[model samples]
Target: MNEEEIVQYFKCQLQEDTNVATAVAAIKTLLEFLKRDTGKDYDKCKKMMSERGELFLKRISMSRNKITTLCCPFIKDGAKILTHAYSKVVLKVLEEAAASKNFSVYVTESQPDLSGKIMAEALRNRNVPVTLILDAAVGYIMEKVDLVIVGAEGVVESGGIINKIGTNQMAVCAKAQNKPFYVVAESFKFVRLFPLNQRDVPDKFKYKADTQQQDLLEEHPWIDYTSPSLITMLFTDLGVLTPSAISDELIKLYL
Candidate 1:
């Protein structure tokens, strides 16, 4: 593939793989290619990257809008929604629902990156009342929360959820609490491969040991996988699905 074609392929693959580092590397390679092919036009290359980023953002936003429109009718007014991490899909959902003033949200300050802090801040800026809690507090808070709404980094055909490190625990807590734990994600994030189970999957949390604090690596992995039964629904660009429906939905994506 040529420079642009390779970049586009990488985007598509990374969207499926949900590997942020890989995506970044691919983007960097594309930038290098641009510099080589169209010398001294760094500004033009930057502009192209910005525009492409915007287009990807818009696609995800549209997907989130579709899921929200489908699911909102089922959500009661003033429902307490719990979420983790900073996801564009999650942000778009809250943004779209902001005008309706339909629901209140609780977010976890996802450790390490503290991505949820960004989400909470965005919601608060939009005038949405947000309760920010520590990662360990999710279980204690789940009893009071009506529903758990999380975003996925990647999903597999077996209905497994790959997301921020603390999400699996939250899903377990929601299951114990008998509360609905839903995943809000774009269909593009779904991976077609299936693992034997959680143990068989590769750990997503490896970082350079000497570069960062030892405790940081000890405490948090970048992602965790939640079992299918713990999830009540999977909200995607297509529509809302129960765990049993994920395989079928995923198949259609490839077909």
Candidate 2:
């Protein structure tokens, strides 16, 4: 395929799935395929790429399941869990834990897209008690919750995380209230990025591709960065990791 066609195909696949694990896996697989100097046998490359893509998808699914199962013990009976945005891994953790321990979940409105409403509805279907809250009320209810858990778009080399907008605010609130702030993400979400601040985050990762605003000041960012210090720990298929230990894991994986 031509360069432009490859770029367009990559964008389409990313847009199709917002799951960080799945999206990054696809991107990595694509990059690996593109790097190969396959001699005129492009058809062989196509078939091999297709097979690898399927395996990556399965690995992502397994990673999520393992992390969720590990997180089950953290959800004690009658505990209240606070979450921001929609995360399939977080949802699975709640649902699986519910079978043995009854608990409640507080979901932020997760604005601009209202993805939290979808999360609330999904939990309700699973018979988990759900409370939908305004984005501004995260602090107001922080003291009432035992812990704060959320998903991430990317886990940077600094051990900080980039997630949906307002995640930073939620993490700050949790720290102030002495509540544990946990991040549940697949190891694949770990990227080589080191965003020093919110502004350092790439715009393509923050905004939709079709955004046509005349000025960036006129639009709200879709994501924000939460510093590593605010996080209590991270739950991943690799095992529960401390924020400080993330760099070591990244080195093992990427170096």
Candidate 3:
């Protein structure tokens, strides 16, 4: 299928699935499979797409497992983790940690959608200790946090991440407090885009808030770029890596 068709197919799937990591993986795998289609052979394309879909599912499962197994070691006894927004991979690691160890999580009410609240409730349902906070309170809670872990929407070539709008500030706070800021993401989330500034990020990520007050609309953004310099490490399926190591991996895999 063409790009538009592929996008629409996944858009429908996204409406049915709330996990960003899964949707992203599915999209990436489908696109990669299509990119290798040299002939417009419909029958062969369907067969290949089906195979790619199965591979995508398996990759997602393994990636989550690898991340949780590797990253849970960081969640020591009585550890306090501060997080922004909701990432399925991040939640999986936290869940795995809580199953065997005692730890607490502080989630920011990532605004526009308050996805952090959703994350907090998910953890509470699992009987894991959790605290909810406002997006602006990250700095206030930084001192008490042993580590900062969040999810990524996309990881650019520069090693920065596009994530919930408040994540950049949260990373900045963690850096200032000498805390480790980590990102939980699958390899598929890495893209070639190298965004230098907030303005360089894709416009599609900007939220259009509809409110009675005009100024309030202008202030709401769905996502923002967090520079790699602020991140302590990235917990990816490939392994735990420094931000600077991302480029080498991308070259080995895709170049």
TM-score of each: 0.73, 0.84, 0.80
lDDT of 1 by residue, 18-128 (tens): 445567685877678666775557778779989999999898768877988866655577888899989877777777776776788999999888988999999999888
Candidate 1 clashing pairs?
A: none
Best-fitting candidate, measured by lDDT? 2
lDDT of each: 0.78, 0.88, 0.86
Tens-place lDDT per residue, model 3, 49-107, is 89999999999999999999989988889999999888899989998999889989999
Residue 238 in model 2: lDDT: 92
- True lDDT of residue 236, candidate 2: 93
Compared with the true structure, what per-residue lDDT tens digits does model 2 show for residues 1-255? 865566566666654434344655666676676668565556787789899999999999999999988888877899999999899989988888989888899999899899999999999999999999999999899989999889998999899999999999999999898999999999999999988888899776777543442355666789999999999999999999998889999999997
Off by over 4 Å in 1: 1-58, 204-219
Better of 1 and 2 by lDDT: 2
For lDDT, candidate 1 versus 3, the one ahead is 3
Model 1 Cα displacement at 86 (Å)? 1.1
What's the best-to-worst order under TM-score?
2, 3, 1
Q: Give the best candidate by TM-score.
A: 2
